[model samples]
Target: MKAMSKWNKSVALLTALILVLGVFAAGCGGNEESDAIKIGVNYELSGNVATYGTSCKNGIMLAFEEINKNDGVLGKQIEGVVQDNKSQNREARNVAEKLVSEGVVAVIGPATTGNVQAEEPVLTKAKIPLLATAATAPEVTYDEKTKKVRDYVFRVCIIDPDQSQVMANYIFDELKLKTGSILVDKGNDYSVGLGKTFKEYFTAKGGKIVAEEGFVDTDTAFKPQLTSISSKKPDFIYIPAYYNQVGLIIKQARELGVNLPIMGADGWDSPKLVDLATADSLNKCYFTNHYSVEDPAERIQNFVKAYQEKYDSTPDAFAALGYDAGYLMAEAIKQAGSPDPEKIQQAIADIKGFEGVTGKLSYDEKHNPIKEVSIIEMANGKQKLIKKMLPEH
Candidate 1:
């Protein structure tokens, strides 16, 4: 009886030992699964450009959520750490540094050109891939002679030179505005880039720029500048800046009896434009943008439906570009078969003929996309689609 009891006790001890080892191995494996690949997001969440930044951030998050739902990149879950720059240059640089320190394989944004310019060099030094979703300044990816990008910088949107030429053609040929005044936002890189290009091509198209003026982004009263522009008796006014200042400029321009056709760049795609400008004041205003919500593409319609269901409103160009940027990154990672920064960068450079909700996307050698643009007009306090142009190149 004693021998049998001792044998039973030994068997019980062995069973307990096996159970402990099994649990230990399982715990380690579960932890490994939980620690997944990381991506970083930097944007202007708390300043003047907060609206565009937040919209882009939401689009990226939505895309990442969808990608993770279908198993994830390289069989591992993906995670994102988002940072806000508050639209300050110093904060933009700090945000980029923080994202790099978090060990993300890639970082997206600082959506505006000013913020991207501030952050690009820091990201380049870290050797992490940085994709700017809406920075359209020509200088973002080029030098004068070579037009080559710095090692770590890239942009997913069309550059200012392309947009400027498109706007110039639309205004001179389509609208037939021969003489105009230029009012630019002096503080923004986007504004400066677009303003310079428009001036160059408008003159080339035989349109005279009668008066040129500038305002800081934070300025609310354009009465003084508008007064001068109106005195010039121009046929139109070109405000190459975001909607916030554009609205104020329009409202003030009309109050001072400077009612001419107003034209602008993609920065004007916001509900705030209509909110600030009156029905009569906005009738002749127009701007160029990425994609139109009115477009009949199935992919665009599906994205619109999803966005409406989520945000309870229509999605703008900022959101569309953000969604496209996320899709591009994911596609490149998939094509590269790994998240190695060098491989992914090369694969992104080689991306051609990618169909996105925005439009058919192809990257240029300088890391800008070759895509079509839409011209939008405001009527009755709503956006009306005017025309779409395929890039002539």
Candidate 2:
């Protein structure tokens, strides 16, 4: 009887041990599954700015592929959760919320300033770092009223003030233009902000703004505004709007015999612009951009080659900015050595002299990238690099 009782006790002990081991193995498997780090991408994938968002998404995916090929950041594979905001403000905010709810470590883009602004409050409250790819409004990172940089917002592109001023200086000094007319999209924060800065700097540099006109994003008739500005006889017409409206404005202006050279900001970097306006209509037009494929630098050349090989198309400024933002986020995560948002944010702020496809980028106190601006001209229906403008202080 004693032997049987002892045998029963031994079997019971062995069964308990097996159960414990099974639980431990299951826990290990769960941890391994959790090792896949998720990053969120919010862009206007199917709306008015679909072209810009598609290019950005392509660049971001390429960067992720390269990172995964090299074992990823912090020994974990990156899984991107992409959401289409439809180029609507409310949709952008909703997408941001959904990404946060899904446990993303960081958010990458919304592409436009308005969308970025729409989603900023949500991200700020949640303490998630937002790395904007192409949103360049000055107020995106800096708050004038508070006189402080927003702690959680950062951008990979030059702000409107810098980009607008670059074009302003180029028109004033390089092109030797004295007077200009402004055509602004009143509904767009990007256009209005760029227009305001260009006017401020252009006039400060002894250039005259002979006429100013405004149009809504829905307005198809720019002929009346062009007629008024053309009568002013300014040396150039500054259209600080997106390519969609700017293309129409340029075509209509040409039809009205307004032949002065037209200048714009980075919003003009799209192939659709050529389709909307004739190649002849875009002649002598220039815009400030982030990168030019014509650049002879080895880094630029390699990126262009790889992009062309992968996408079978040349990358534009939006693609360069998206690539830069993706790599920047990965570098920050690697430096942090963890998926903690606060740690990643600090790591991003500390980055300096990081070589990017666009340029060597360093974050300023305002979390804005310190980089050069590329001025591109539409020559023979192709974008040609005209000059590189370095930041002044």
- 348-372, model 2: which lDDT tens digit per residue? 8999998898988898898888888
Best by TM-score: 2
RMSD of 2: 11.3
Candidate 2 wrong stretches, greater than 4 Å:
1-33, 218-224
The lDDT per prediction is 0.83, 0.89
Give TM per candidate. Answer: 0.81, 0.84
Supply candidate 1's per-residue lDDT for 162.
82
The lDDT, on a scale of 0 to 1, for candidate 2 is 0.89
For 61-123, candidate 1 gives per-residue lDDT tens digits of 777877889887788676766789998889999988977875778888979888898998887
lDDT of 2 at 162: 85
Model 1: residues with Cα > 4 Å off, grouped in runs: 1-35, 74-76, 86-98, 143-148, 186-189, 215-233, 255-258, 391-393
Question: Which candidate achieves the best lDDT against the true structure?
Answer: 2
